[model samples]
Target: MTDPAKAARRARHDAIRAQVADEETEAAEAEAAENAATLDVSLHLRISHTLDAELRRRAAAEHIPTSALVRKLLAQAVRQHDACGLTAADVEEIARRVTREELHRSA
Candidate 1:
Protein backbone atom coordinates (compact mmCIF):
# COMPACT_ATOMS: atom_id res chain seq x y z
CA MET A 1 0.00 0.00 0.00
CA THR A 2 1.26 3.53 -0.81
CA ASP A 3 1.14 6.51 1.51
CA PRO A 4 -1.89 8.76 0.86
CA ALA A 5 0.24 11.94 0.83
CA LYS A 6 2.68 10.46 -1.70
CA ALA A 7 -0.17 9.31 -3.95
CA ALA A 8 -1.73 12.80 -3.87
CA ARG A 9 1.61 14.39 -4.74
CA ARG A 10 2.06 12.03 -7.71
CA ALA A 11 -1.43 12.84 -8.92
CA ARG A 12 -0.70 16.55 -8.75
CA HIS A 13 2.52 16.09 -10.72
CA ASP A 14 0.69 14.14 -13.42
CA ALA A 15 -1.94 16.86 -13.68
CA ILE A 16 0.72 19.53 -14.14
CA ARG A 17 2.46 17.48 -16.83
CA ALA A 18 -0.82 17.01 -18.68
CA GLN A 19 -1.54 20.73 -18.56
CA VAL A 20 1.89 21.58 -19.95
CA ALA A 21 1.39 19.08 -22.77
CA ASP A 22 -1.98 20.61 -23.61
CA GLU A 23 -0.47 24.10 -23.77
CA GLU A 24 2.32 22.94 -26.10
CA THR A 25 -0.20 21.25 -28.38
CA GLU A 26 -2.26 24.44 -28.57
CA ALA A 27 0.78 26.51 -29.47
CA ALA A 28 1.77 24.12 -32.24
CA GLU A 29 -1.77 24.17 -33.66
CA ALA A 30 -1.77 27.98 -33.69
CA GLU A 31 1.51 28.07 -35.59
CA ALA A 32 0.22 25.59 -38.16
CA ALA A 33 -2.92 27.70 -38.62
CA GLU A 34 -0.84 30.80 -39.24
CA ASN A 35 1.16 28.93 -41.87
CA ALA A 36 -1.97 27.67 -43.61
CA ALA A 37 -3.35 31.23 -43.81
CA THR A 38 -0.21 32.38 -45.67
CA LEU A 39 -0.62 29.76 -48.42
CA ASP A 40 -2.27 30.89 -51.68
CA VAL A 41 -3.11 27.51 -53.17
CA SER A 42 -4.95 24.37 -52.07
CA LEU A 43 -4.68 21.43 -54.45
CA HIS A 44 -5.32 17.72 -54.07
CA LEU A 45 -3.70 14.93 -56.02
CA ARG A 46 -3.78 11.14 -56.08
CA ILE A 47 -0.40 9.48 -56.48
CA SER A 48 0.84 5.90 -56.73
CA HIS A 49 1.65 4.04 -53.55
CA THR A 50 5.43 4.04 -54.14
CA LEU A 51 5.51 7.72 -55.01
CA ASP A 52 3.28 8.62 -52.09
CA ALA A 53 5.47 6.77 -49.62
CA GLU A 54 8.60 8.40 -50.95
CA LEU A 55 7.03 11.83 -50.85
CA ARG A 56 5.80 11.28 -47.32
CA ARG A 57 9.25 10.21 -46.11
CA ARG A 58 10.92 13.15 -47.83
CA ALA A 59 8.41 15.61 -46.47
CA ALA A 60 8.86 14.25 -42.96
CA ALA A 61 12.61 14.64 -43.23
CA GLU A 62 12.21 18.22 -44.45
CA HIS A 63 9.67 19.09 -41.75
CA ILE A 64 7.05 20.09 -44.35
CA PRO A 65 4.05 18.50 -46.03
CA THR A 66 4.33 16.73 -49.38
CA SER A 67 2.35 19.55 -51.01
CA ALA A 68 4.75 22.17 -49.73
CA LEU A 69 7.74 20.16 -50.96
CA VAL A 70 6.19 19.87 -54.42
CA ARG A 71 5.38 23.59 -54.50
CA LYS A 72 8.96 24.51 -53.60
CA LEU A 73 10.25 22.19 -56.33
CA LEU A 74 7.89 23.67 -58.95
CA ALA A 75 8.83 27.25 -58.02
CA GLN A 76 12.52 26.42 -58.37
CA ALA A 77 11.96 24.80 -61.76
CA VAL A 78 10.07 27.85 -63.02
CA ARG A 79 12.82 30.19 -61.83
CA GLN A 80 15.45 28.08 -63.58
CA HIS A 81 13.45 28.04 -66.82
CA ASP A 82 12.89 31.80 -66.70
CA ALA A 83 16.62 32.35 -66.24
CA CYS A 84 17.30 30.74 -69.67
CA GLY A 85 17.29 34.24 -71.29
CA LEU A 86 13.79 34.22 -72.78
CA THR A 87 11.98 37.50 -72.22
CA ALA A 88 8.27 37.90 -71.40
CA ALA A 89 7.74 39.37 -74.87
CA ASP A 90 9.15 36.19 -76.43
CA VAL A 91 6.71 34.09 -74.41
CA GLU A 92 3.80 36.30 -75.46
CA GLU A 93 4.79 36.05 -79.14
CA ILE A 94 5.04 32.30 -78.94
CA ALA A 95 1.62 32.05 -77.30
CA ARG A 96 0.10 34.29 -79.99
CA ARG A 97 1.60 32.17 -82.77
CA VAL A 98 0.36 28.96 -81.17
CA THR A 99 -3.16 30.39 -80.78
CA ARG A 100 -3.21 31.39 -84.48
CA GLU A 101 -2.06 27.95 -85.53
CA GLU A 102 -4.73 26.28 -83.40
CA LEU A 103 -7.43 28.58 -84.82
CA HIS A 104 -6.38 27.83 -88.40
CA ARG A 105 -6.37 24.10 -87.69
CA SER A 106 -9.91 24.27 -86.29
CA ALA A 107 -11.21 26.31 -89.25
Candidate 2:
Protein backbone atom coordinates (compact mmCIF):
# COMPACT_ATOMS: atom_id res chain seq x y z
CA MET A 1 0.00 0.00 0.00
CA THR A 2 1.27 3.50 -0.96
CA ASP A 3 0.73 6.71 1.03
CA PRO A 4 -1.66 8.97 -0.93
CA ALA A 5 0.06 12.24 0.08
CA LYS A 6 3.53 10.95 -0.93
CA ALA A 7 2.19 9.61 -4.23
CA ALA A 8 0.60 13.01 -5.01
CA ARG A 9 3.86 14.84 -4.29
CA ARG A 10 5.84 12.44 -6.47
CA ALA A 11 3.37 12.87 -9.34
CA ARG A 12 3.61 16.66 -9.13
CA HIS A 13 7.41 16.56 -9.10
CA ASP A 14 7.48 14.24 -12.12
CA ALA A 15 5.09 16.47 -14.01
CA ILE A 16 7.18 19.57 -13.32
CA ARG A 17 10.35 17.82 -14.46
CA ALA A 18 8.64 16.63 -17.62
CA GLN A 19 7.36 20.12 -18.39
CA VAL A 20 10.84 21.60 -17.94
CA ALA A 21 12.37 18.95 -20.20
CA ASP A 22 9.77 19.65 -22.88
CA GLU A 23 10.35 23.40 -22.74
CA GLU A 24 14.13 22.92 -23.05
CA THR A 25 13.72 20.62 -26.01
CA GLU A 26 11.36 23.09 -27.73
CA ALA A 27 13.77 25.99 -27.16
CA ALA A 28 16.70 24.00 -28.52
CA GLU A 29 14.82 23.03 -31.68
CA ALA A 30 13.72 26.64 -32.29
CA GLU A 31 17.29 27.88 -31.89
CA ALA A 32 18.55 25.26 -34.34
CA ALA A 33 15.98 26.32 -36.93
CA GLU A 34 16.89 30.01 -36.50
CA ASN A 35 20.56 29.21 -36.99
CA ALA A 36 19.82 27.10 -40.05
CA ALA A 37 17.87 29.94 -41.64
CA THR A 38 20.96 32.18 -41.64
CA LEU A 39 23.07 29.57 -43.44
CA ASP A 40 23.76 30.31 -47.11
CA VAL A 41 24.46 27.66 -49.74
CA SER A 42 25.72 28.47 -53.20
CA LEU A 43 28.17 27.38 -55.85
CA HIS A 44 31.84 27.69 -54.87
CA LEU A 45 34.95 27.88 -57.00
CA ARG A 46 37.76 25.29 -56.80
CA ILE A 47 41.23 26.63 -56.16
CA SER A 48 44.59 25.48 -57.56
CA HIS A 49 47.05 23.18 -55.76
CA THR A 50 49.04 25.85 -53.88
CA LEU A 51 45.96 27.85 -52.88
CA ASP A 52 44.10 24.69 -51.90
CA ALA A 53 46.98 23.50 -49.70
CA GLU A 54 47.25 26.88 -47.99
CA LEU A 55 43.51 27.05 -47.40
CA ARG A 56 43.47 23.49 -46.02
CA ARG A 57 46.37 24.24 -43.66
CA ARG A 58 44.74 27.43 -42.38
CA ALA A 59 41.38 25.69 -41.95
CA ALA A 60 43.02 22.81 -40.04
CA ALA A 61 44.79 25.26 -37.73
CA GLU A 62 41.45 27.03 -37.10
CA HIS A 63 39.61 23.69 -36.63
CA ILE A 64 37.18 24.52 -39.46
CA PRO A 65 36.65 23.02 -42.88
CA THR A 66 38.45 24.59 -45.88
CA SER A 67 35.13 25.56 -47.40
CA ALA A 68 34.05 27.25 -44.18
CA LEU A 69 37.30 29.23 -44.00
CA VAL A 70 36.90 30.36 -47.59
CA ARG A 71 33.27 31.26 -46.99
CA LYS A 72 34.12 33.41 -43.95
CA LEU A 73 36.83 35.29 -45.82
CA LEU A 74 34.65 35.79 -48.88
CA ALA A 75 31.75 37.02 -46.78
CA GLN A 76 33.95 39.60 -45.03
CA ALA A 77 35.41 40.75 -48.33
CA VAL A 78 31.99 41.08 -49.91
CA ARG A 79 30.63 43.00 -46.94
CA GLN A 80 33.54 45.43 -47.02
CA HIS A 81 33.21 45.91 -50.76
CA ASP A 82 29.50 46.49 -50.51
CA ALA A 83 29.69 48.85 -47.53
CA CYS A 84 31.33 51.74 -49.39
CA GLY A 85 31.16 50.48 -52.94
CA LEU A 86 34.86 49.83 -52.59
CA THR A 87 37.23 50.94 -55.33
CA ALA A 88 41.03 50.65 -55.52
CA ALA A 89 41.30 53.87 -53.51
CA ASP A 90 38.83 52.57 -50.95
CA VAL A 91 40.90 49.41 -50.54
CA GLU A 92 44.04 51.45 -49.87
CA GLU A 93 42.19 53.65 -47.39
CA ILE A 94 40.77 50.63 -45.56
CA ALA A 95 44.22 48.99 -45.44
CA ARG A 96 45.72 52.17 -43.97
CA ARG A 97 42.95 52.36 -41.37
CA VAL A 98 43.40 48.70 -40.42
CA THR A 99 47.16 49.03 -40.09
CA ARG A 100 46.82 52.15 -37.97
CA GLU A 101 44.29 50.43 -35.69
CA GLU A 102 46.53 47.36 -35.28
CA LEU A 103 49.59 49.48 -34.48
CA HIS A 104 47.67 51.73 -32.12
CA ARG A 105 46.23 48.72 -30.27
CA SER A 106 49.63 47.03 -29.97
CA ALA A 107 51.33 50.12 -28.55
Candidate 3:
Protein backbone atom coordinates (compact mmCIF):
# COMPACT_ATOMS: atom_id res chain seq x y z
CA MET A 1 0.00 0.00 0.00
CA THR A 2 1.26 3.51 -0.84
CA ASP A 3 1.77 6.04 1.94
CA PRO A 4 -0.66 8.99 1.50
CA ALA A 5 1.87 11.44 3.08
CA LYS A 6 4.60 10.33 0.65
CA ALA A 7 2.23 10.75 -2.30
CA ALA A 8 1.31 14.25 -1.15
CA ARG A 9 4.98 15.22 -0.78
CA ARG A 10 5.79 13.93 -4.25
CA ALA A 11 2.86 15.84 -5.72
CA ARG A 12 4.03 19.06 -4.05
CA HIS A 13 7.59 18.53 -5.31
CA ASP A 14 6.41 17.94 -8.83
CA ALA A 15 4.23 21.04 -8.73
CA ILE A 16 7.13 23.15 -7.45
CA ARG A 17 9.44 21.89 -10.17
CA ALA A 18 6.84 22.57 -12.83
CA GLN A 19 6.38 26.11 -11.55
CA VAL A 20 10.12 26.74 -11.61
CA ALA A 21 10.32 25.46 -15.18
CA ASP A 22 7.42 27.70 -16.23
CA GLU A 23 9.13 30.73 -14.72
CA GLU A 24 12.37 29.94 -16.51
CA THR A 25 10.54 29.60 -19.82
CA GLU A 26 8.87 32.96 -19.27
CA ALA A 27 12.19 34.61 -18.46
CA ALA A 28 13.82 33.14 -21.59
CA GLU A 29 10.96 34.33 -23.79
CA ALA A 30 11.22 37.83 -22.32
CA GLU A 31 14.95 37.86 -23.05
CA ALA A 32 14.38 36.72 -26.65
CA ALA A 33 11.84 39.51 -27.07
CA GLU A 34 14.30 42.08 -25.75
CA ASN A 35 17.03 40.85 -28.11
CA ALA A 36 14.65 40.95 -31.07
CA ALA A 37 13.80 44.53 -30.18
CA THR A 38 17.50 45.43 -30.39
CA LEU A 39 18.10 43.78 -33.78
CA ASP A 40 18.68 46.00 -36.82
CA VAL A 41 16.19 45.75 -39.67
CA SER A 42 17.03 45.70 -43.37
CA LEU A 43 16.42 48.74 -45.60
CA HIS A 44 16.15 49.44 -49.29
CA LEU A 45 17.68 52.75 -50.36
CA ARG A 46 17.14 54.49 -53.71
CA ILE A 47 20.67 55.44 -54.57
CA SER A 48 21.47 58.58 -56.52
CA HIS A 49 23.41 58.35 -59.78
CA THR A 50 26.68 59.22 -58.08
CA LEU A 51 26.19 56.59 -55.40
CA ASP A 52 25.29 53.98 -58.00
CA ALA A 53 28.36 54.86 -60.01
CA GLU A 54 30.56 54.51 -56.96
CA LEU A 55 28.97 51.21 -56.03
CA ARG A 56 29.48 49.88 -59.54
CA ARG A 57 33.12 50.87 -59.57
CA ARG A 58 33.74 49.50 -56.13
CA ALA A 59 31.98 46.23 -56.86
CA ALA A 60 33.82 45.75 -60.15
CA ALA A 61 37.13 46.44 -58.42
CA GLU A 62 36.26 43.74 -55.91
CA HIS A 63 34.84 41.37 -58.58
CA ILE A 64 31.48 41.17 -56.84
CA PRO A 65 27.97 42.19 -57.83
CA THR A 66 26.94 45.76 -57.05
CA SER A 67 24.07 44.65 -54.85
CA ALA A 68 26.27 42.20 -52.92
CA LEU A 69 28.92 44.85 -52.32
CA VAL A 70 26.35 47.29 -51.08
CA ARG A 71 24.91 44.69 -48.74
CA LYS A 72 28.33 43.79 -47.37
CA LEU A 73 29.34 47.38 -46.84
CA LEU A 74 26.02 48.22 -45.21
CA ALA A 75 26.25 45.21 -42.88
CA GLN A 76 29.75 46.18 -41.83
CA ALA A 77 28.68 49.78 -41.25
CA VAL A 78 25.78 48.67 -39.09
CA ARG A 79 28.01 46.42 -37.00
CA GLN A 80 30.56 49.19 -36.54
CA HIS A 81 27.85 51.65 -35.68
CA ASP A 82 26.40 49.34 -33.03
CA ALA A 83 29.84 48.56 -31.66
CA CYS A 84 30.30 52.29 -31.06
CA GLY A 85 27.10 52.34 -28.95
CA LEU A 86 25.28 54.29 -31.62
CA THR A 87 21.59 53.74 -32.30
CA ALA A 88 20.09 53.53 -35.78
CA ALA A 89 19.24 57.22 -35.68
CA ASP A 90 22.82 58.02 -34.77
CA VAL A 91 24.07 55.88 -37.64
CA GLU A 92 21.69 57.54 -40.11
CA GLU A 93 22.68 61.05 -38.98
CA ILE A 94 26.37 60.22 -39.15
CA ALA A 95 25.97 58.74 -42.62
CA ARG A 96 24.15 61.85 -43.78
CA ARG A 97 26.92 64.04 -42.38
CA VAL A 98 29.59 62.01 -44.17
CA THR A 99 27.75 61.62 -47.48
CA ARG A 100 29.22 64.81 -48.92
CA GLU A 101 32.73 63.84 -47.93
CA GLU A 102 32.27 60.36 -49.43
CA LEU A 103 30.84 61.76 -52.67
CA HIS A 104 33.70 64.21 -53.04
CA ARG A 105 36.21 61.47 -52.29
CA SER A 106 34.62 59.27 -54.94
CA ALA A 107 34.74 62.11 -57.44
Candidate 4:
Protein backbone atom coordinates (compact mmCIF):
# COMPACT_ATOMS: atom_id res chain seq x y z
CA MET A 1 0.00 0.00 0.00
CA THR A 2 1.95 3.00 -1.38
CA ASP A 3 0.89 6.57 -0.72
CA PRO A 4 -0.40 8.53 -3.75
CA ALA A 5 2.00 11.35 -2.99
CA LYS A 6 5.00 9.01 -2.99
CA ALA A 7 3.89 7.45 -6.30
CA ALA A 8 3.56 10.90 -7.87
CA ARG A 9 7.01 11.86 -6.72
CA ARG A 10 8.54 8.65 -8.14
CA ALA A 11 6.80 9.21 -11.49
CA ARG A 12 8.13 12.74 -11.64
CA HIS A 13 11.66 11.54 -10.89
CA ASP A 14 11.49 8.91 -13.64
CA ALA A 15 10.22 11.43 -16.16
CA ILE A 16 12.98 13.87 -15.30
CA ARG A 17 15.63 11.16 -15.75
CA ALA A 18 14.17 10.22 -19.13
CA GLN A 19 14.17 13.86 -20.22
CA VAL A 20 17.78 14.30 -19.20
CA ALA A 21 18.83 11.20 -21.12
CA ASP A 22 17.04 12.46 -24.22
CA GLU A 23 18.70 15.86 -23.93
CA GLU A 24 22.17 14.27 -23.61
CA THR A 25 21.56 12.13 -26.70
CA GLU A 26 20.44 15.18 -28.67
CA ALA A 27 23.48 17.17 -27.58
CA ALA A 28 25.86 14.35 -28.63
CA GLU A 29 24.19 14.05 -32.03
CA ALA A 30 24.47 17.80 -32.60
CA GLU A 31 28.14 17.80 -31.66
CA ALA A 32 28.90 14.85 -33.97
CA ALA A 33 27.03 16.55 -36.83
CA GLU A 34 29.10 19.70 -36.45
CA ASN A 35 32.39 17.77 -36.32
CA ALA A 36 31.70 15.44 -39.24
CA ALA A 37 32.55 16.26 -42.84
CA THR A 38 30.31 15.25 -45.80
CA LEU A 39 27.85 13.64 -43.33
CA ASP A 40 30.10 10.54 -43.11
CA VAL A 41 30.39 8.26 -46.11
CA SER A 42 29.93 4.61 -45.22
CA LEU A 43 33.02 2.36 -45.16
CA HIS A 44 32.28 -1.24 -44.32
CA LEU A 45 34.77 -3.80 -43.07
CA ARG A 46 34.46 -7.49 -42.22
CA ILE A 47 36.00 -7.68 -38.77
CA SER A 48 36.88 -10.84 -36.86
CA HIS A 49 34.82 -11.91 -33.84
CA THR A 50 37.67 -10.97 -31.52
CA LEU A 51 37.82 -7.43 -32.94
CA ASP A 52 34.03 -7.09 -32.81
CA ALA A 53 33.92 -8.14 -29.17
CA GLU A 54 36.77 -5.77 -28.29
CA LEU A 55 35.03 -2.91 -30.05
CA ARG A 56 31.74 -3.59 -28.25
CA ARG A 57 33.45 -3.82 -24.86
CA ARG A 58 35.46 -0.62 -25.40
CA ALA A 59 32.45 1.26 -26.72
CA ALA A 60 30.30 0.15 -23.80
CA ALA A 61 33.00 1.31 -21.40
CA GLU A 62 33.14 4.70 -23.16
CA HIS A 63 29.31 5.03 -23.27
CA ILE A 64 29.39 5.27 -27.06
CA PRO A 65 28.40 2.94 -29.91
CA THR A 66 30.87 0.43 -31.40
CA SER A 67 30.70 2.23 -34.73
CA ALA A 68 31.64 5.52 -33.10
CA LEU A 69 34.68 3.98 -31.43
CA VAL A 70 35.82 2.44 -34.71
CA ARG A 71 35.31 5.77 -36.48
CA LYS A 72 37.41 7.53 -33.85
CA LEU A 73 40.20 4.96 -34.18
CA LEU A 74 40.11 5.15 -37.98
CA ALA A 75 40.25 8.95 -37.93
CA GLN A 76 43.24 8.90 -35.58
CA ALA A 77 45.03 6.28 -37.67
CA VAL A 78 44.48 8.25 -40.87
CA ARG A 79 45.72 11.48 -39.33
CA GLN A 80 48.85 9.84 -37.93
CA HIS A 81 49.63 8.00 -41.16
CA ASP A 82 49.19 11.17 -43.21
CA ALA A 83 51.43 13.18 -40.88
CA CYS A 84 54.13 10.50 -40.99
CA GLY A 85 53.79 10.06 -44.79
CA LEU A 86 53.69 6.28 -44.37
CA THR A 87 52.44 4.23 -47.31
CA ALA A 88 51.38 0.60 -47.70
CA ALA A 89 54.78 -0.13 -49.23
CA ASP A 90 56.53 1.32 -46.22
CA VAL A 91 54.44 -0.84 -43.88
CA GLU A 92 55.16 -3.99 -45.86
CA GLU A 93 58.90 -3.26 -45.93
CA ILE A 94 58.96 -2.59 -42.20
CA ALA A 95 57.12 -5.85 -41.48
CA ARG A 96 59.52 -7.80 -43.68
CA ARG A 97 62.54 -6.27 -41.96
CA VAL A 98 61.20 -7.03 -38.52
CA THR A 99 60.33 -10.63 -39.44
CA ARG A 100 63.80 -11.21 -40.95
CA GLU A 101 65.50 -9.76 -37.91
CA GLU A 102 63.44 -11.97 -35.59
CA LEU A 103 64.29 -15.09 -37.63
CA HIS A 104 67.98 -14.25 -37.63
CA ARG A 105 67.94 -13.81 -33.86
CA SER A 106 66.14 -17.14 -33.41
CA ALA A 107 68.61 -19.01 -35.61
Highest lDDT model number: 4
Question: Which prediction has more favorable TM-score, 2 or 3?
Answer: 2
List per-prediction Cα lDDT, in the order shown. 0.80, 0.78, 0.77, 0.83
- lDDT by residue for model 2 over 1-107, one digit each (tens)? 46998899999999999997876676566555645876655776766999999998997676555666777788799998789666899899999999999999999
Instruction: Quote the lDDT for 96 in model 2.
Output: 99
Whichever of 2 and 4 has more TM-score, that candidate is 4
Task: Put down candidate 1 lDDT per residue, 16-88, tens digits, no spaces.
Answer: 9999787667656755775677776677787799988988898767666666677777788999988889789
Model 3 misplacement above 4 A = 1-43, 86-107
Per-candidate TM vs. native?
Answer: 0.41, 0.42, 0.39, 0.52
Query: Rank by lDDT, descending?
Result: 4, 1, 2, 3
Model 4, runs deviating above 4 Å: 1-16, 27-36, 85-107
- Screening candidate 3 with a backbone cut-off below 3 angstroms (N, C-alpha, C), the clashing residue pairs are none
Model 3 error, position 101 (Å): 33
Worst 10 residues of 3 by lDDT: 26-35
lDDT for model 2, please. 0.78
RMSD to native, candidate 1: 9.9
Residue-wise C-alpha lDDT for candidate 4, range 1-107, written one tens digit per residue = 47998999999999999997986696578558745754667787798999999999997777676777787898799998889977899999999999999999999
lDDT of 2 at 8: 95
